[model samples]
Every structure is written in structure tokens, then in C-alpha cells.
Target chain A: MSHSSPASSEISFVQHHDDGTFKKTVRKVTIILSVVTIIELLCGLAIFKLGHGSHMAVLMIKGLVTILSLAKAFYITSYFMHLGDEIRNFIMTIIVPLLLFVWFIAAFLIDGSSWRELKNTAAGSKPATEQVEKAVAPGDKK
Target chain B: MSSAAIPAGTKWWSGGKSPFNLSYGKMMMWYFLMSDAFTFGAFLIAYGTTRFSANYWPDPNHVFDSAPFIHGGAPLVFVSIMTFILIVSSVTMVLAVHEGHNMNRKGVEKYMLWTILGGLAFLGCQAWEWTHLLTGDNPVLVNGEIVEMATTVKVNPWGEVVPGMMHNGHQVTTPGPVAFGGFFFGITGFHGFHVLSGVVINIIMYIKTRLGHFDQRGHYEMIEKAGLYWHFVDLVWVFVFLCFYLI
Candidate 1:
């Protein structure tokens, strides 16, 4: 396999060429990713500098940041990982399950929030009084 | 039999080349990375749920307000620099992979070295941030007196008492701070470990390229595989940035 053979030429997806297209592509990707990141940073700063204002405003800023982040993720995955050049089926094999992963997160978060609410109400009603009384009893003895 | 069916010399299920038109190793790497993405996703979602459920959460602006040389408060400046470093390193890794495809051993060596340095620099920045979190003065204004506090899994000085809650029938004395610190440290620490491993792998690849190993092999698929891992690490960081730093 180490020996140089004409057959090995067929293995690579991109034929080695003297043309600098590969270099140019890499440079373009770097610029795009960097610009997106800088935009995200600026958005974060702008939120703080401009002040959060209303809850809705803060949420909108966060939504913008998430959108920027997802854009960066797409570029890195497709270009850097070479998924863009892979076969359509191969891309789906990776991407389709990842969509499921996102769904898993959304489902679990909803469940977690419900649990949090249950815990909060439980603490608010019974545990809060019991713990405070327990504390007061100890203080009286001391 | 149909003309497309069973060519005599080639067994129908024989594993010769990639059926999926990808190398076996690369396919397996993709599978591993996809699973890893789910792990990070779960962590981030847990962080989000816990944070939103809480009444009072740490203000990211106040909590992450520290830069490298500048004193006082500069929200997210340092983390932004770290993000830039990782993105730049991903670019270098992709360039190295491109050079690998071209069988340019020297190009691969140079870019791999740069990527390794970027990883190290990011790790160093994380170390500084962690130290700052542990030791820096975080004074919370309580009853008009500034009470100094540090971040711990059990307690956090970043915000008010996490609304008291119950978990599995046990009462939580401190809710919000504990969960916040736990998730912050846990998720970021896991990501930092990935960065460390990526650096180590890049160092090995760099040494091999310098030794003409890939040149002798007549192909640079090894470097491409390593590039896949590096790119995946960078991808994970994008989400981590959104979950931890920005949001």
C-alpha cells in the first residue's frame, strides 16, 4: 500500500492539481467562519452595551446568537468535515440521526422543566415550613 | 437472473471497497462523532432546562466579565477570543487535510503544527478562566453588604439562592447556584478534555508527517481522519459557546 501506484490515484475524491482552488476554498471558509464568530461576539456585546431593556429584547438577542452559532456549525460540518463532498446517503446517515438528537434535547428539556415545577411547589408548601421550624427549634435550644 | 444481480466473480455481500462510497474508518469515525454530538446535546439541554426553571440565575454579563490583560469587567471578551482561536485552528486543520489530499507532506506538517498551537493556546485561556472563577473576588450585594463568594458545585457566588427545590424526596438547600456551577463546570470541562485530546492527536500527526510517514504511505487518509476529529471538536464548541457563554 505504501508503494506509489497509478491505482492509488483513483482513491482520493479530489484529484491533485497545480491549480490553487483548494487553497482558495480553505481561505474562503476561514473568512466566513471568522466573520460569523465576530458577528456573534458583537451581538453578545451589543446586548450588554445596549442594555437588555425588556425580557423580549434579551430573548431576541439570544435567538440571534443561537442562529449565528447554528450557521457556524453548518459551515464547519459541511466544509471542514468534507460532508459537502460525501455521497448523499452518507450525509444523511450522519444528519438524519442528528435531527433526532435535537428532538431528544427538546423532549428532555420539557420533562426537566415539569420536574422543576413539581419540586418547586413541593418545597414551597411542605418542605419550606418544616425546614424553617427545624432550624428555629435548634436555635431555641442553643 | 437480472443483469444487475450477482456478477459471477464478485460476491453480493463481499466487502471489498466502501459500499457507502466512504472508507470504513471514516464511516466509523462519523458514527462515533454523531454519538458524541448527542452527548453534548444532552448536557446542554439539561443546562438549559435547569436554568430556565430557576427564578434567579447568574447574569452571564456579570459572571463572565474578565479579559486576559484588561482588569475590571469585559463581558465575554476572553471567551470570544477562545472561540476565534478554535475556529482558526479548524481552518488550519481543513487546510492540512487538503494538503494531505494533495500529498504535500510539508504542507500537512506546517498546518498541523499551527493547529496544535491553537489548541494549546485555547487550553491555556481556559485554565486562566477557571482560575479566575475559583479565586477572583465575586462580591454579591446582600443586605447592603458585599459578601465575597467563590464558585463551587455546592455553592455559587454568582447569584441569589437558587430557588429551593426537592429532588428524589431530598430537599435541596441551595438550588440555582449549585445546578448552575455543576452544569457550567461539567459541560465545559468535558469540552476542554476533547480539546486536549485533539491537541495530542494533532501532535502525533505532525510528528508522523515530519517523518515522511504519510508520504511513504502514498496517501494521507490518516491526516484526514484526524482532521475529522478536529472539526468535530470545533463543531461541539459552537454549541457549547451558545449554551454556556452567550445564553
Candidate 2:
């Protein structure tokens, strides 16, 4: 029962602790992730069926999938990466970069949407009839 | 009179004291994982933004249905198998590290060899999937018509898909669209690269175990470190599968 004495044999490399519970924890995480993944796939399939071609539905489903995927990513990072045993500051270090990335993505989205709007407006006012009329007139004169 | 009383030589980063009794090699692997984490994060975020910007993205079921001799092909089945393989490999890696800790050399070799095999198998599957995707085995609709697909590499973040890269359904098309192959290659290609690298590392460790490097060290921190890397590879694949196949 004394904790001070060390084992002398070659097979005593591992600390004399039972890893049964550790294995259980790993199994639990695996099951949880697998279930979550199945749910995500189902949702993805259903959304395509229920909301095909509807822009709003598309946006909503896409957002849901992204969030769920991020959740799975975090679970794997935290548990499988051993970040759960690491210091809180280390976890924050990993997380802060992700926040900065979200900021970058937001900027990109703003730029993209504004550019789309600008393009739409530029072509929005052109009348098919008038444009055809002008083209035909120029051809007729020629 | 006690050797344990004497202060040990400490490294600069570790303050001349070994934190967690870890070696330089192990510590370096940790930092590598951290930085690698950032790299994969950026790739995933970029993928999200690209998906958001695209007016319409193909559904995974429609994109990944490749059955050699089946009808109503689906995405979940093949990708799910890939996911299962990766996860099982990760478990084998953990068991290898555990066996290494126990000084069970034979156990370590057995598990590590299995882990290496798993990694190789995963890489092979990924390569097959990529060829199938790039060559247009799966169906992709272009311009609102269910026309045959074509892909070409053009300038992009990862690489360009020029016109005539692939042809499908009787349509000769140029690189489909910029984001199409871009995201596909960017996300999965990166993960595949990690798996390939992991296979190499695991093989090295497997050979070293055969050579009795770990037994002399009295610890298997090397195995633990390799486990860390291998797990990261598997973890990244989870995200990639979700993004590319499910989400």
C-alpha cells in the first residue's frame, strides 16, 4: 500500500492504476459522436427533400449543418486531442484563433453580399424590351 | 546523499524542469498539434464561407452516390464506413499507447501495426474517393440541366481545376465552377494529407518498437506522442466527413 516504492520489473512502466474507467469514458464519447453524426445526416437528407430550391430553407439548413459540424469538431478536439486534460488557458488558446477566424469569415460574407447587391442593382434596371429595341434599331439603320 | 534532491538540468522553454516529465520530442509534438489545429480551422472556416456564398450547392446524397452494383445510391453509407474506419483506427492507436505504457512490447507492436494498417487503409479509401470525385463517377448538375459533368482546374486556394479535367453525362465542361472542386479538394485533401503523414509516423514507431527503442527508455512517451498525432488525424477526418459528406 506504500506509494513511495517503485516497481523494479521491466513491465512496470505504466503507473499501477486501473484504466477501466478511462476506457469507459472513451467508449461513451465514441457512442455520443456516432449518434450525433447519424442525426446530422438524417437532418441533411430531410432538409434537401423538404426545402429544395427554397433559398431561405437552404440558408437555414446550411446554418444548422455548419453548427452541428462545429459541435462534432469541438467534441473530437476536446476529448480525442486530450485537450480536456490540458490547462484551461491552452483550451482558450485553441478557441481564440477560431473566434478570430469567425471574424474573418464575417468580413468576407459582408463583402460578398454587398458585391452581389451591387451587381444585381447594376443589371436590375435594364429592360429586355428596350435593350432589344435599341439593338434592332441600330441593326436596321445599318 | 540523495540523487533525487539534486536539481535537474532544465530546458529553456520548460524552465529547466520537465513538466509532466515529458521529453523535448513530446513537447514539440504538442505545439505541432496546436499549430496544425489552427491550419485545419482556417480550412474549415473557409469552406463554410464558400458554402454560404454559393447560390446552390449540391446535396451530399446527390454528390456521393457511387455504388458499383446498387440502385438509389446514397452518401451516408460509404462515408459512414469511412468514418467507422477512422474511428476504429483511433481506438487502435490508443490501445497501442496503453500497451506501450504497460511495457508490453508485443502488445505495443501488435496494436501499433494494426494502427498503421488502419491508417494505410484509410488513405487508400480516400485516394479512391478522390479519383471517383475528380473523374466524375458521381453526378453533378451544371447550369440547371441534369447534364453530364465536367471539371477543369483553374486558379484557386488549393489548386485550379482546368477545363476538361473531367467529363460526365456527355457534357464537355470546363472546371465546373471555382468553388466546386476548390472546397472539395481543400478540405478532404488536407485531411488525406494528414492521414498519409500519420501512416508514415506510425510505421516508424512500429519499426522502432520492433527494434526495442521504447523498452530501453523505460517509458513509451514516444508512443503517447504518436497517439496524440494519430488522434488528431482521426479527429480532423470527423470534421471533414461532416462538412463534405453530411453537412
Best by lDDT: 1
DockQ, every prediction = 0.27, 0.15
lDDT of 2 by residue, B144-236 (tens): 333434332332211222344444423232223477677777778888888888889999999999999877766667787889999888877
TM-score of chain A, model number 1: 0.69
Candidate number achieving the greatest DockQ relative to the actual structure: 1
Candidate 1 stretches greater than 4 Å from native: A1-19, A50-52, A116-124, A127-142, B1-15, B141-147, B161-176
Local distance difference test, candidate 2: 0.65
Q: Best by TM-score, which number? A: 1
What TM-score do all the candidates reach, one by one?
A: 0.82, 0.74
Quote the lDDT for A7 in model 1. 24
Q: lDDT score, residue B181, model 2?
A: 73
Model 1 chain A: worst 10 consecutive residues (lDDT sum): A1-10
lDDT of 2 by residue, A23-85 (tens): 786787788777877777777676657645676876677688778767777667666655655
**Which pairs of residues have clashing backbones in candidate 1?**
B162-B176
